[model samples]
Target: MAVAPQVLPHTAISTWSGFVYQGKLALYHCLKLMSSDYAANRDLKLQLESQDDFAIFRRQQCLSMHQVKAYKDPRFSAYSDGISTQRDNARQRGVALAYFHVAREVTNVPATFVADYGPVRFYTYPIPPDAAGNVIQSFCPLNQVDMFIRDELSSLLVNAAMQPAWKNYIVANIQNTLEAIVNLKVIMTHSKIHESTRHQTVIAASEFIEFSELYDVIEANDYAPFENEAFFLSRLQIDIGTYYQEFCERQDSLSQAACQKLDDYLAAITSLNVEGMKAFLRATMPHKKGRFKTLSEFKDQSLDRDAMRLGMFTIFWKLVQTARNDGSDVAFSWLNDGLFYYPTGIHHAAEHQESICHDIMQQAISEDVECLFECGALITSAIDRPSISDVIIGIDATEGVDTAEHELLRENRIGNYKKVAMISLNNVPESLKDAEPD
Candidate 1:
């Protein structure tokens, strides 16, 4: 865990920076173990040095720290797309030896220690071994590794920054380490979820947390995270899906509606062409073609947008049908992602929002539909009452029009009234409000 400032010179720093930023040097390079004596100090040292034996893989322009002339590979690099581990090389033993505790804890991490690395706060919890195996011979690799990583990060902080906070102790580069651990996870989880899935780290979640925390710290002054909803939403949705899946699995029946949907979905799975089936599916669920802003539009311009949503929904519904027809598993997979699933990725669930929309519309009807209707009638009444329809006559000014920017009110030149307000076309039948006269 001993880490001292490597004393990277200014020129070396600039060169390394350019190499990393330009994608020359990947975050990690695989190293091999030296001799059979994994415990021997000299063996471990030689193994770590062996990492330099292989020419680093990259395009020719990427070579900056090269000590030798460019040499072509006798046999191409073993890994193509990022491989977790290269054939155990002697050169990597130094890292292994230095990070041996990291290796130990990988096998012996404790449950409480893992929880301490709260996914929410993302502050890593490290557990280092003070004394070796107890007299009882009980060992927790997870605890050992966490402690090692935590301690190592603490030491690195002394050199990395002038004043490193507790936050810096949780390293972001641990994804590679984690991925390797998950793949090499001989360690088991009691949770019903697949060990692979339960532990699989999404890089984006880290980015989101880092960006969010960065925003919180620096937001008061000048720092603004350029990343938008898309960056956050994709990862958030994955988390949501994972959580929902867990909830569903934990309970015998997660939701009656979900169960019914699955049942209907299953029943319809066989008879793909039935309109009765499709109709039932349409009634019970949301589809891609039905994407919408809101069911209750208070503006005229919203109709086109809603129409576009409806069109997307139609495409989504059929797309869902097609995916279902092709394979239910595929349909579920796509639904989980909110994508069209096969090709289009048109966000089809928006199309069938009515399933949720029905609840909203019903609440409006049940609460105060009559009072709403009556109040609206008074303002639009052609006969009795103080109707503001003809009150504001001969008005030519557009001063107050800015408030109606969304087309909640339509401009109508009715005879003497140059521009009179009328309820927008897409709004409910409830906008006939009494207004001031000109």
Candidate 2:
């Protein structure tokens, strides 16, 4: 009887981080093979299974040793020269191994492994150390794998564009992969992929399918509150300045000392000093006898208190901007009381069109802006309705809203109700005061 030809499985040997790269690489190759007849011609079928911290690629029935005992054993170190020796031994036993080193410096592996075991690929995932020279070990490996996938997909997209059938198949599959990742039920290491890369990949896939629309909806759902709060704050800042200036110009009774105090109050507000703002209000606009018997009466008479009340209209006007900007078949109009034609019909529109809207909002929230929750709630009430129309948001709210709003109104003012409605911000609706973002 003739000896059988020993079939060698394609093996990837690396540490935990390297397993991430291996998994992505295997997925990429699997996609490539499925999109063409290449794998069928070679009688090969690549299947991938994700374990606890690593991934394994199964070719037919043969299971790689790294997947079973090696990855689990804490004593098993990838840096050891034994890795190279094992690779050599695998080669002799009709198995091929590719070793990936996570770090730039390879210490345990000898020069002989470098010379005989083919080129040792080093994946240097550059993660900057903190002020104390300590690395964030959790993010390092994920970052490296993300960088690898981003580069691979980018190159694949460019090359796939040449072949129509291959392009269509790959694009569809990549879009599906992205959707799956986004809709993942549980949080995993893969969830921490860089936001920029995710957006780029989504945009790239959108060119071939309606994936961007879906991605935009997902992004808006995730970051709409933060984006709305940022917008509301920008509008309120302007409203506060306008009210303060108007009050100072009209009131001859406002002394130089009072003006200085008002300036200090503005600064405190800008810096997000909540206690300082409260203190200023209490000290300068406290309730008095006779005419000002209650805090509400004092608030009505005081310029600073009036300005605070006037700031509520900023939320109203921002929502008006949102409604008017919405490209819907149903017309939108602001009533005399600063309420829209269909107040219940309005919906929150995403402020930014960039795929990185979530990241932008995350950064904004991290800055710890004052009244974030309140502003977000007010904006949410204006837009979060059951019957919402088509919303079209095309402004960079991170920049000054005045400029963006002017340009937006100029371009998209057609078919909208043009009646200007002016209302005192002090008389905000009780419903709006009670509402919150969902």
Candidate 3:
């Protein structure tokens, strides 16, 4: 159902936090922040799910709001003590509603209840649930969530962007979150596919609506939240092509809607200028001085080996500066697409005809994507599968540029260096460079 105008409505808000949220929303007029700093503590989440911890969660939320209201108790309303007293009713109620994440988990708060009037108005109500199959714990208000997390997550991400000492921990958490969100989408897709196939086999047509209302508040972020790496999509995999041809017809019909959505999205993305669009084209690409001097210069370029290393830090900083000042988290999902679409982006020794992996590795290391270290006794490691990548980038070679790799190369590393992956060794040939150990 379309959300009523009251819950996160479109009017200009008046509360301080609401104003801040508005300010951030204005800043990122069209951006989404997929944080490199998002860390879902499963242990903590599970602990929050426990019946014992419900009170703590509620208390934290309620007290936090109470304190906030008191501090910013500007002359907004007359309800001196209640949540309605705030300048922005939706903003205050939002925080209060989230406390229901606790109430629904621990107490007898039903997920949805009928608020009956003479008209029997049925608003989407918050119901309580136990730790088992709990949805409330996972319910993050698309608008309210990062308002609390921005500062903490930004500090963490900026630090990690610099390749912090605890970068391994951060990378592991990020990967784990990615896996969880991806798996969640997969699970949702499978369930939808099963339901869809069954419905098609039995009935003529059926539609499955979802709690995608969350996708509504994510508008300021340009619905980019829906395109998130972890977005929940219901993929219907009917036997599209079959001897009976019934499934084929069904797929053909559905493809119309799907293709239209895809076209709209693609068109929106294409509106970016040449340089902005090229970042997504490849990871790293070299440019000649005068070839299409401005970003308007375009050429039909195929996939290249060093594509991942092609972009600069300033590009991401531009996006970040736009996002942070406006008010959105950096969407790190772009990294996933980069990895999948440009698998061979990492610099390879054979491709470039030189032992550049040492330089890349040095860069990844100083920036905190350090794969391994030959410590006193134990083999110290930072990231997962860098050992595998060491082989791909040819960084494991005992000979070739071992002792003299430039440390300056390390400082040049940019953006989530820990997640840096390697692809093919289609680089320079054997006579590319002397295997100098200087």
Using TM-score, give the best candidate's number. 2
Backbone clash count for every predicted candidate, in the order shown: 39, 1, 31
Alpha carbon lDDT at 104, candidate 1: 15
Per-candidate Cα RMSD to the true structure, in Å, reads 22.0, 23.0, 23.3
lDDT, each prediction: 0.23, 0.32, 0.25
Ranking by lDDT: 2, 3, 1
Question: lDDT tens digits, residues 223-337, model 1?
Answer: 1232222222222222222232233333442234343333233222222222232322222222123322222111111122332223222222222222332423222212222
Q: Which numbered prediction scores highest in lDDT against the true structure?
A: 2
Over the stretch 97-187, how does candidate 2's per-residue lDDT look in tens digits?
A: 3334332233444556556654322323324697888653321232244454444444445453233334343444343343233222111
List residue ranges in candidate 2 displaced over 4 A.
1-22, 28-43, 47-78, 101-109, 115-141, 158-438
Cα error of candidate 2 at position 110, Å:
2.7
Task: Answer with 1 or 3, whichever has the higher TM-score.
Answer: 1
Q: By summed lDDT, which 10 consecutive residues of candidate 2 come out lowest?
A: 369-378
- Return the lDDT, model 2, position 404: 47
| TM-score result, candidate 1 | 0.23
* Local accuracy of candidate 3 as per-residue lDDT tens digits, 1-438: 986673211211111112122222211211112222223211111111111111112211321111111122223232223322222332533433212111011222234422211111111212257668543342223234334334333344445334334434343333223323323332232233333423421221111111122112221223334333222111000000011112112232323333333222222222233333333222233111122222323232323212322222112211111111112111111222223111122332334422343454443332222122211010011111232223234343322334455443332332233344433322212222123211
